[model samples]
Target: MAMLNQIEAFQPENGASWELYVERLNFYFEANDITSADKKRAILMSVCGPSAFVMIRSLLTPRSLNEVAFEEIVSKVKEHFNSAPSKIVFRIQFHKRSQRLNESITEYVAALRNLSENSNFGNTLDDMLLDLFMIHNRCQIAGSTSNGTNLHKGLSAI
Candidate 1:
C-alpha cells in the first residue's frame, strides 16, 4: 500500500513528532493487516525512533517484552505523551478557539479540525456545537458589524 511504503520510510523525531508517528504507525498496521499483538509490538519497537525506543525499553525493563501485550505498550506511550492536564488544556483551548484578525475562515476551520482530532472529541454533537459557535461568533460579513445573527444573512449578502 502507498501508506505502508510511507510508514516504512518514516523516522519519527523524538518529543516533537510522537503524534505523527503514532498516527502513521496505526495507519501502517491497518494497511498491512497486522492484527497479532506480538507482531504489532515487534513492528512498533522496530519502527520507533531511538529516544522512543529507549523510553519504551526502560518502561518495559521489569517485564519480558515478548510477553507484554501491544495494547499495554500503546497505553504507556499515550499516557506519557498525552497527560491528563494537557488533555484538559487542549479541551479548554478548543472551546475558546477563535479566528484571529486577518485570518481566513478556511484557515480557522482547518485549525479547529486539527484540534478536534488531537483532543479526541469524537462526538458529533460536540463537533456540531463547536462549528455553530464558530459560525455565530466568527463569521463576520463584509461591511457589517453585527452580533448574534444567523450566518445565512452574511452568506446572502456575499
Candidate 2:
C-alpha cells in the first residue's frame, strides 16, 4: 500500500532522530485513518530501522508477537529509546539552563520548549512557571530597574 511505502521510506534513526520519526509516523497514521491495532503493528515492524528491529526481535519470544498489542509494542520501544526524565532531573536541567550570550530570544525559547516537552511534566501551569522562571532568571533587560516586573514589562523595557 502507498501508506506502507511511505512508512518504509521514513525509518527512524536512533537517539535524537527518534522523536522526529515518531511525529512523522503519527501524522501518517492520523492522515490515513490507520486505527486498527494489527495494521499499526505491521506498519511499525515494517518501518523499523536495523537497530530497532534487532532490539524488538530480541525482546520477542516465539509467541510474543501473537500476544503483544500494538500499543504495548510502541510503549516498549519508547521506554527503551526515549525514557522520560525524572522530575528532579527535569528541574535540575531547567534551573541550570541559561540563555547563551549570542543566542536570540527566539532560539532560547525554542530550546526551553524542547526541554519542557521532553520533561513530560504534563501540566500547562508548570510549563508556564518554568517559562516565567527562565525568562526572569536568564533574560537580562537593558537598563531595567529591577527584576520584580512581569515578563512583558521586562521585554518592553528592552
Candidate 3:
C-alpha cells in the first residue's frame, strides 16, 4: 500500500484538543499491530516520557530521516538517550523528567535497519518507501523477498 500525503492544515476542524488527538492516534496505532504493543509502549516512553505534548507534535509533523535529516534526528535522539539513559528494571519505566528523551526514536533506527537489509529495495527503495509512507502511510513496492527466494516458485505459490 502507498502512504497518503497528510497536510497539517487538513486535520479535522471539530475543535479537537491534545488529549483526544493522542487517544485517537494511539488507537489507530494499536489497531495496526497488536504484537508491537510492548515495543510501542517502550518506544513511546523512551521518546516522549512525561510530556503528553510530544505525541501531538509527532502527529502534526511528518518525520523523514533522509541522509541529511537522519543525521540530525540521530544526534537529537542520542543526546536525549545519553542524558538519562534506559536501565533494566523488572519492568521498564522511561523516566519522564529525563531531559531531551525521544519516545519513538529507537523505532526510527529499527526501520532504517530493516530497509537497509533489503538489497533489491536498497537505499534507493529506502527513499521510495519513505515517500510512499509519507504519501499514503503505507508502502508501495514491487513484490520481492529480502531473503533469497526463487521468484518463480514464490509467484507460483501465489
lDDT of each: 0.64, 0.64, 0.35
Task: Tell me the lDDT of candidate 3.
Answer: 0.35
Per-residue lDDT of candidate 1, residues 1-158 (tens digit): 33356444234342244557667788878888888889888888777757678888787788877878988987876776665346567666677777788887667667666666656666553344345454556653534625543444544433
Model 1 misplaced stretches (Cα beyond 4 Å): 1-3, 8-24, 86-88, 91-104, 116-145, 150-158
lDDT of 3 at 148: 41
Q: What is the lDDT of residue 53 in candidate 3?
A: 29
Candidate with maximal TM-score: 2
What is the Cα-based lDDT of residue 44 in candidate 1? Answer: 83
**Against the hidden true structure, what lDDT does model 1 obtain?**
0.64
What is the C-alpha lDDT profile of model 2 across 1-158, one tens digit per residue?
45433754334342254556667787878988898888877777777767777777666655567577877876766776665557678666755677788887777667766666655656563345435544566554634636455545655555
Candidates ranked, most accurate by TM-score first = 2, 1, 3
Which stretches of model 2 miss by more than 4 angstroms? 1-24, 62-67, 78-85, 100-103, 117-139, 142-145
- Residue 4 alpha-carbon offset, candidate 1, angstroms: 2.9
The residue-by-residue lDDT of candidate 3 on 1-158, one tens digit each, is: 33233212212233223334345445645565534545444433343333432533353356522212322433454443344322332012221111123534235435444433423443354443333333432222234333343333333332
Could you report the Cα RMSD, in angstroms, for every candidate shown? 5.8, 5.2, 19.7
Which RMSD does model 2 reach against the true structure? 5.2
